[model samples]
Target: MNEEEIPDKNIFMMCEALNCDALTELPASYSIRSCRPDELGIWKMMPFDDADSAKEYEGFMSNYFTTTYSGKEELFFAKTLFVCDRQNKPIATCLDWKAYDEFNTIQWFKVLKKYEGQGIGRALLSIIMQRLEMCDYPVYLHTQPSSFRAIKLYSDFGFSLLSGDNFGIRKNDLDECLPILEKFMPKKYFQKLRIINVPKEFEDMVNKYDTNQF
Candidate 1:
């Protein structure tokens, strides 16, 4: 298929955004906590496992490892942060770390349906944001309108948005991935979930992301 060709139903999104600083915090927690080494894969796969297209989600995970994380799931595990329940069940998760050059992003953020309203996701993301703020580079993340709930959280944390049509978006990216962006999220709906990017003049590249993988 050509670059401008339409993507299939299984396609993912590439919307981009960045945060100049961390602007969120977590509520008090007496039971749930960060993921431990022994409880990695299960938690990492929980959100995808619960999806209608589990196979596609897993395939995307593998592709992501190849393109960004050097195909090393272990390295990703080390970089991941999962909030677990008293019995060690994965409640929420996120990965905030260096992705390319000085760009650090929050990846694979999720919260199980069973634990959505209690602030686990907010707390977990806050912890990751704290880690990112200490880093010297700019913190960024890739999410789409489908991840509707995340828009507010990322916006609150200062992540500015750039869609496929945004001038700040690089020509190469827009040309090669525009179809997928359009398919994953129509331009009109995507605009509503948009965020502002810091250093507005700098060009933006959207990585393969579906922040609401859950």
Candidate 2:
């Protein structure tokens, strides 16, 4: 139920902001910055101490207890970031991914519920967009309509949908991509979206990103 690319009102939307693409300017309020070298280990992920009831959340993220997602390499680790409050506790998070080059994307992007209204999400996203500015490739993300305001944040940052119309994934890999999608997403979500081949946006960025790695 976690890997499906199925588009759901609640499942979060999948979108991307290509490097240097024109963006709709928007003002931000919060102070957003990347984690320092020393804080990387401690600020790797959002605090989810209770792994006992992960299903109770929207995604099965809590299943993994670390600050960062599983299988991340040093490159992914350096790209992780946090939003600290006055006391320096990380209240929001975002991560960079490259396991599948074309699918190089930002994942686990969220602001703790208590910090939702202060524009922390947009600040996090804005800084993320800046990180991708030097890449010839695009920065990818996934979200859903149920998150009303989040959609606006993405659009404002120049993210647009990646569908069969705009994206064209190689046919040979469809067989391999299908299983991964099915494992995480549900069929019902795609039924409503009718967007064929979510993986079509994968742009072979794995090799392209090597030079960009810190």
Candidate 3:
């Protein structure tokens, strides 16, 4: 989908009006919407730029197609929105959707660093949540431990940690997997584990960790 194919110009106008110096510099009111084919170029500006990243993106789309097209689900919502320049060139994005399951999880939310701190991420999240509520399902999402902003946004919207082993970690050794698990697991879950018989060695591993490395 090209810029010409975007049925609504309001998205473009609203983003442009912010006059953001960089994609990450966008204001709070700026929100995300569905992406058009032509807007894919802008969507590509998201942080990941490697083959592994590309493959994961393709996998998400494939899952959407199979589940929605196969009639296993009723609604399949994904996003491909552009953070536009004054001239409507996309500068940032957040794109993903929910499957119509009782456990609806929001996946693949991202934005360019240049557009951070502006309300763009929040806006996109709100749009997706509204859509999810309309479908009558509760929402959930997973984010890297380093994605402090994303976690805060989800929390602000009333999403809390689901109980009992949300981390999906099975390995007993902390050095082998705890760091990665920490990055993605909810904070409340992490706190709960701390009260148990956590080994001093494991606590040390977690204490010195930095989520951005992942």
Candidate 4:
């Protein structure tokens, strides 16, 4: 199934400041590190792991790597990270990617379902944010209404929703997403969401790439 066949809501966000207070220590049994070359397949599938979505993601990831990391496959694998269990099996993954070689953006951040409640996500995000701290300001990311929990986590880390009509080739669903969030998220978490205008620099960088493949 191609992703566009399924209806989805997309939202864009920006973080002007890193909130160190949101950082948490990883549980003792798991370790965080760069992904191994052999784990490229694992890194690609972890976030969108359901069998039904496999076809869609396989296509998406293939295009993503080819268009976004073409000659930088080695760098992609080196920068891609995983939170591994005691057995060194990857349970979660993400990376601090520079979109269009202009500014920082968080990409493919996810934790396996069984590992969800632990501090692994926060810990991994904190480590990535630390790596991105000096690279650029106002980091950006793309997500959806379904990821309300992660959105709350992002807000805790100082990311605010971008209230605008578009982000690159994608339409901003911030307005539509708010009602869904309010209906689905607990009132407190939903209430804490903040909004910000899109900065020209971030807008330009996002549009810099011809992301039709994505």
The best candidate in terms of TM-score = 4
TM for every model, in the order presented, reads 0.62, 0.53, 0.48, 0.92
* Number of the candidate with higher lDDT, 1 or 3: 1
CA shift at 144, candidate 2, in angstroms?
2.5
Runs in model 4 lying further than 4 Å from the true structure: 1-7, 212-214
- lDDT, candidate 1, 134-165, per-residue tens: 44345555554445456556655555454334
The CA lDDT of each predicted structure is: 0.53, 0.49, 0.43, 0.82
User: Model 3 compared with the native: what TM-score?
Assistant: 0.48
Scored by lDDT, model 2 comes in at: 0.49
**Alpha-carbon shift of residue 212 in model 3 (angstroms):** 22
Candidate 3: which stretches are off by over 4 Å?
A: 1-33, 38-79, 100-103, 166-214
Best by the lDDT measure: 4
Instruction: At residue 112, give the lDDT of candidate 4.
Output: 88
Please, what are the lDDT tens digits per residue for candidate 3 over residues 1-214?
Answer: 3322322110000000111221233454443345564544334435465557766676555554454335522222234455565555555554434333223456657766676776777666555555444344334344433554555555555554332221222213323223443555577644433212333433343235332111
